[model samples]
Target: MTTAERSGAVQDPDARRLADLGYTSEFHRDMSLWANFSLGFTYLSPVVGVYTLFAVSLALAGPPMIWSLVIVGVGQLLVALVFGEIVSQYPIAGGLYPWARRLWGRRWAWLTGWVYAIALLVTIASVVYGAGPYVSSLLGLTVSTNTTIVCALVLIVLVTVINLGGTRVLAIAALIGFGTEILGALVVGGWLLLAEREHDLGVLFDSFGAAREGSYFAAFLAAGLIGIFQYYGFEACGDVAEEVPDASRRIPKAMRMTIYVGGAAATFVCLALVLAVPDFGAVISGENADPVGGVLSTAFGDTGAKIVLAVVLVSFLSCALSLQAAASRLMYSYARDRMLPGSGLLARFSRSRGVPPYTLLVAAVVPAVVVGVSRFSEDAIVKIVSFAVLGIYLAFQLVVLAALRARVKGWRPAGPFTLGRWGFAVNVAALVYGVAAIVNMVWPRTPDAPWYDDYLVLLSGVVVVGVGVVLMAVTRPYRHSDAAADDAVRSTAAPER
Candidate 1:
């Protein structure tokens, strides 16, 4: 009883607060506000997200595709506000999983966690997988499926080793990534905008005759993946809530900060590339498959382009690191509650280092296996990664949907942060935006392609959710829990000091 009966004053405030919410502080609470925000910013990785998706979006929707960033930035900001409110109140590890659990119930959380966890793992695979070509180019190796997979595995191992250095190392790496990416974007984007402008601002409004089934709106929606992918890395902040003191207040601000700052950076990068593309017709017509590389090489010459590529590699590394860290926490969260199989093993925490070593391994290993799938077919990776953005959005909507339900049932958000009377309205807007985005993402547009390819995003989502449902029904994992459900409901009033 001695350890159990220690007064709140005897423990770190963050630990005490965790205890109030029925958790012990397993992560080191040494993260400053900027460190927290940097995690999200690095995870967001404006340089990585925009660069990878730029050619695809531009090819699909022309220069006008830049608007997708604005549209998604606004919509996701609404969702971010909703998340800010929920995370401010809960501030638990595993971000979405625990938030869903507290707001709805254990089962709702299981589905949310399952969908989100899968999305995250695949996302990690997608990021590192995409980085393979860059790595090959940088190292003067001939890029091939096998070589790409090798590079991806190497990146995974590197980030995993960095992650095992503990929280401070994670924060430092994130900040370095964030600073480098932003500075690179400013330099590259600014250079492109100022010196290399091939098309004027007028081109942004030109679709270059881009349309799907005679509907540019349809094409635009399909291209919306750029913005969707860029915005999610912000939630990585909330995933490590126990690691940040005053998390209830700081995490929400860090979340919103991530969106605001990341949005600006991403938009700047996209805008610069759009304005700098020397041959838009060639790019959209599929003649210029490597417009991103082409633009960099043309703008900066070989040596300068290589330098920029190095920066992009850093961004990729940081982004993967952040994603792995977030996924590990979600795994730990599930295992801590016995909500998943092998909970005990995954929940194994490093007291000295303050990290979940086993779950971190799971995060790294699963993504590595996914990267290996590319050996069979490179297109297979593309089709699989397409689900990443949609799966994440679907999982996000579920959380938003859960928050709305809890709100409708009179669970007014009670934390240092609240939307006040505006909470319900904002929550509704977030849900509507999320559903609209989900529909846009899942709408099959490519009729000429095989049915499987056209419907890949929707099919992948169904398969992930379907698998989650089957596992839930068979295992009933949520039945065994120590989640402090009662405390979650009753302790909604601004936790103990």
Candidate 2:
């Protein structure tokens, strides 16, 4: 037998699986099941999400806003199931980009990657900027535009350093971050329940009259925005699928588990905060704008609050790290396929570390520049978060919609994970939810504010997608290699069992 044939015969299943999909294994593939889960969990970061949006949710819908957590959680679970099915079959990196390409066509895939890549890079900035106030509070420094911008820049640099440490270090850091976040949630939530319960469980069902229009449903929809934003980072699991052993099977499980664990933790934390608030009326009326900090300080004294904030800071840093890592991988994946400009440099992997250093550098620098925009625009962070949410959900729904189309066209589950008879129903429900999410996210909440400010997310999303369409049409980036694309599609027509 030929030496190449002998090598193929003895190769790991993951390598063979990649070969069957018309690509060779390029990643180190050292991430364990737990490590893979950590990447998703840290990316989801309940602490970061809760802390960042707690005040906004409280103001929008009062205590009942907590229900948005449950509603968005269930909807996201449906979406995650559909994603799991796709990832199980393809098991490639770049998450939605690759799945969209395989299920649809090159143009669709290019747009998906274009939108998603920008969303992820901007998300890193939003996450770091969100963490700035907490870090400032921890350091006894006042949070101003300058301070927040500086802090965000510092965070971006620190995240870049950790990402440069290679996959093993990144995995270890993610696992540690996961532990800290979960433990902090339990300890803080448990303490609030035991010692500082200010209201009964019924408060969660009460809106406390914060629905300015006196319509509880309107308030609930507004609060649902937080839940929609928090559950998404779970896709970070599939973004690194190439680096996980037995990725076809393990990556899907990791994605679902991330939602399960992250959703549960987030729900618990929100409930604890709602039940622990000393003055719900004051919080909702803007009298106590920092409800999370107030609750922490009231439940656990200043020293204890500081301690919890330390854990939260770790969660934020880890979240930024995972975000950058996921973005780099997606960039590398697109570059490897020559879909992006300057693909050669961005696609180069470090011989020793097995990382795309240039890609990582780009990921870090882009966010830093995005964060700098805060200096000129006071509402920049809020608008950017809105843009990130709209962009990401749009990208996610594209894949889900593509999957639904494939289902109608006789796409069966070839991976270990399958939704079986429930797949069709779940896909339909997920698509419905995705459409609703996009509409809810883009709707202007503050009609009284400036037109640009009120409709920032909607306008920005349209511009970004419009730009992507224009670029795709002008560049025709996918026309360079029809033969290779054909080969890949044929090879993956029926993935090996």
Candidate 3:
């Protein structure tokens, strides 16, 4: 089928689309841009990205952690360009789902949306897990696994409350949290470097020899794949595309810019960590034990470190809130499309709050289950998160590649945020990187790691996508609403911006 035949038309073709979609276009384009960056950077800035960079840098690349960051950044940039092009053309909410449907056909589009939605749910779960350690550290208490699980639930509830309030509140919180996270990263990273000015830079830069001999390439590849998680959530911008003014142009520009900025910042922070904190042996060992908390403890001293830990805690909470905000909209979007089991329930948007409360509740449950399971074993939690990230990446790549194919076949729309003529080259690079990451993800480095767990995440992801496909397959044909269906799907299909 031609691209236009495959992808559904934008719902709400008229000016009253926002009212019909259960939201007002009250958010300005700048707020939309900041909100996207706020969610994207808060999760990475001084918290998640820091920990991962530290582990990989110390264990795999040494000071060259920047290399992995650069590689992953480039890889994501390619994908972001594709998103940029698509967002400019389709600038509605339910960004990827609609884009996928338009480019790949409705069946594949349904599957894409489902996979993206579940992937975010799993992200919320895992990021909540990342936050628990910081909460415990902030309070000066030792945390048992049980306590961690409890903390995770409390966080989930908190984020859920914020999300159910509406997009505006979430956007405001994201702005505040984004500033806090960036400042925290700077303070901690800069303090460490200046604090240890006498440390040997050569040692830090050349530490890759310490890993299993000849494993640098594999380690680098794995680290690069893992690094993709750091630069993610740009699509969250697309989830609320319909909520913004001039969405068609602004959404894609915001997405493309978000990747560039987030990637650059991530690169700088990784460099700072390697130069400042050369004790990879200790950091890696501690991360193996406690991940977020372990690294923060070593980076700053006891009295001062607690304050830093508080910043980290807030950052984690912000990330959880961001995920809920994005995921609920996704649920709302899917329900609007009649792609989910409880379409009626998820479709209920509170007039008073102007948000989808039931959808928020549904998104909360998935993370809750994952967090509960996490309490039983640390290894299990890590594997599940790793699997989930890989699954999300796979879905993103597929949608992206499909879009590129559509472009190749001469399906072009006028977009202010065009990637110029270089769009094809960028997409080709993205496709290559994505395929490599997927292949490398399934290959076990450690024997105890189950490939099936990866399959389980993929399978679950596939099932969610299938639900969307099934809705289209089983239901009677309803005329495309431009007002009701795909346009309403906005809450879920956002970019990382």
Candidate 4:
């Protein structure tokens, strides 16, 4: 039988189990496919993505960042298939953390949760850091270190307030942002492509030979690695499982749609930007403006560029809220299983409405810190955010691999989304793509590449993994056989008001 049919076939377990305690599976299924599509798009706006490509692909891979995006996109597609299988099966807000427990046993599950949690925290920082510069630029004010930090803190507080109100507010806000951002991006891209009709199409097509001052393949790889950030926010949907209207049916659909929407939107924006290829020598020349910032300036003039800047700023802020929402879930998920440091408080659902407030507080820290750091140095801020995002993607890919391994061994989940035999092939492709991206990001490019930045990504990832391992060693509770079963249901299944 198919996965959807299988869910109906399975019997619900007895209600008295401790694992079922206080879980809130209350997400509404009111979100349409487009809303789901925007969930990812809002995360991968043209403004932020352009900077990412310039740094990763153009700076390093020359024109190969385009190819890198293609490679990463394909890998993400396969990985999404894995996510499809899992989300369809579990449909819980906890996402990969719960899946890891079920597939790899509890210790491994907690380990997976640790990595995922840390990744989200880092992503929150990156999002805030990315946004602050855009905000500073749009306001025509010089960005100061203290100002950036304070703004980041404010952004976190704003996001926390929105999340506390729950899913309805987020979905509505996301829909509005998605529409505004998409129209702005298309207009900006259309102007660039149409106005620059005289520019060389050949440059856009054949720029691959123009590698940075490094190994050609390594440059290409690093650039492609950077594109991973373009695809970061899709997982945020999974984090809000408790708030999704019809989570079981909608979550997988939302996830798949997110990839399609983000890929198409990103592709359109890139094409427009590529057609207007700035002087490579000039762009790379010291003191040339941010290529993306420069391009928008050309396409819209000063006034229009600032408008685009505002949109980009809003896009990042949207992502900031989404990141906070996702991180809160991660904390709640970890605490739910007693994996994090403050399970009692962090795990507690509000007595008034059953929301987990303490966990939300914990998730607010990284973004606040990210904002503070951006004022010191934009370059350092960007690199730190990039490093953190890389760690998050790595964790995401690893969990997918672990889950795929279990599925290949004849494990089955009763869900609406299923890959069947194609699961293995798709999953393997995703695994390969993820591995390539990780290596690309870590590989050194040239003597010019800062030593601290070069090692920071590696060190941060190591620290996250080491912490997970240590926690596993100290807890010892995860060794139980029943922990591997990891079945959890809502404390009350009635639909949300």
lDDT of 3: 0.66
What would the per-residue lDDT of candidate 2 be over residues 154-199, giving only the tens digit for each residue? 9999999989888888899999999999999999988888888889
Candidate 2: which pairs clash?
none
lDDT of 4 by residue, 125-174 (tens): 76676566667778786776655565567667877887677556667667
The Cα error of candidate 4 at residue 388, in Å, is: 1.8
Q: Which residue runs of candidate 2 sit more than 4 Å off their true CA positions?
A: 1-10, 482-497
Instruction: Pick the winner on lDDT between candidates 1 and 2.
Output: 1
Give the TM-scores of the predictions, in the order they appear: 0.96, 0.96, 0.84, 0.86
The per-prediction tally of clashing pairs is 0, 0, 25, 10
Evaluated with lDDT, which candidate comes out highest?
Answer: 1
Provide the lDDT at 245 for model 1.
83
RMSD of 4: 6.2
Q: Give the C-alpha lDDT of model 2.
A: 0.86
Query: Tens digit of lDDT per residue, candidate 1, span 286-404?
Result: 89988999989999998999899999999999999999999999999999999989888888999888899999999999999988876876475456557888888988998998888
